[model samples]
Target: MGLLKGIDPILTADLLWVLRAMGHGDRLAIVDCNFPAAQVAKSTVTGKDPIILTVPLPQAVSAICELLPLDYFEESSVFYMAPQDGVAMPPEGNAVIDELKSAIATVSSPDVSIAPVERFQFYEEAKKCFAIVQTLERRPYGNAILVKGVIGPDGKDLKPN
Candidate 1:
């Protein structure tokens, strides 16, 4: 077990390494069980298998957000998979995303935007991520991409000089 204090126990060594190694602007995909993680992971920056975590989507996202600084440079640093119908978010998806938004607000700015990408487009975006973390969430569309940001020299979020 990691001896690091205040770190979430859910963040295993492999996950911690991935989170720490990713540079600013690099993306990390947290997808549901139904996502094609292996196929998408092969094309990711790490070019490796997905890191499987036995937790629900909200739990996984909360843990990751605790340590991962979201990109403030981009217009929308976080992205979720939009529903196929494109009219409204499914109830399950809405619940998950609402939780995600609250989790992110704690780490980053309260105003940090979480955009939605079409299903296929999200897969394409996931491929470009540095790594993928597949959670044991059974609900559909419980998938998101988090862009890594850096801590400034002052120990705060990086911003324009």
Candidate 2:
């Protein structure tokens, strides 16, 4: 069966609320299986309830990107988890990047670049984001973070298409 028109079921009500509530420059983090989600989203910390979407990383990340305009002002709006402890980006990370690129293409977004953040730094960043999506992807380094951009008065993207 199909979802309601223009409504993606992959984006749950909680996720949608978080997206809608976020203003421009707000960041959203989509984390892999290995990341610490609950620990970071503590009410004692950011005072915002944690949002977890139990889908695969690529789907969650792409769907989110499709709905939310990315921050074009930044040098890199999307960030992936960099290799840590002398390891490099795993095969899965590459696949996730390909998936994200395809999503950016599907949306006709002008900026398709994704930056890398060290493991601990990524976690710290995620802790401060508007929300975090905990995907079921078992692949190492499948995490990604996205910064939100603004929509213009003419109903066009503020960031170039």
Candidate 1 Cα outliers beyond 4 Å, as residue runs: 85-88
Q: Which lDDT tens digits does candidate 2 get at residues 1-161? A: 34567777888887787888889988888887777777766622245556677788888877887678787877888888887778877787788777766766677474556788988888888877877778887787888888888878977557664
lDDT of 1 by residue, 59-120 (tens): 89889988888888899989999866536677988888887788788766787889989888
Alpha-carbon TM-score of each model against the true structure: 0.92, 0.87
With candidate 2 superimposed using the best TM-score fit, by how many Å does residue 45's alpha carbon deviate from the native? Answer: 7.7
Q: CA shift at 161, candidate 1, in angstroms?
A: 7.4
Give the clash total for candidate 2: 0
Candidate topping lDDT = 1
The best candidate by TM-score is 1
With a 3 Å backbone cut-off (N, CA, C), the pairs that clash in candidate 2 are none
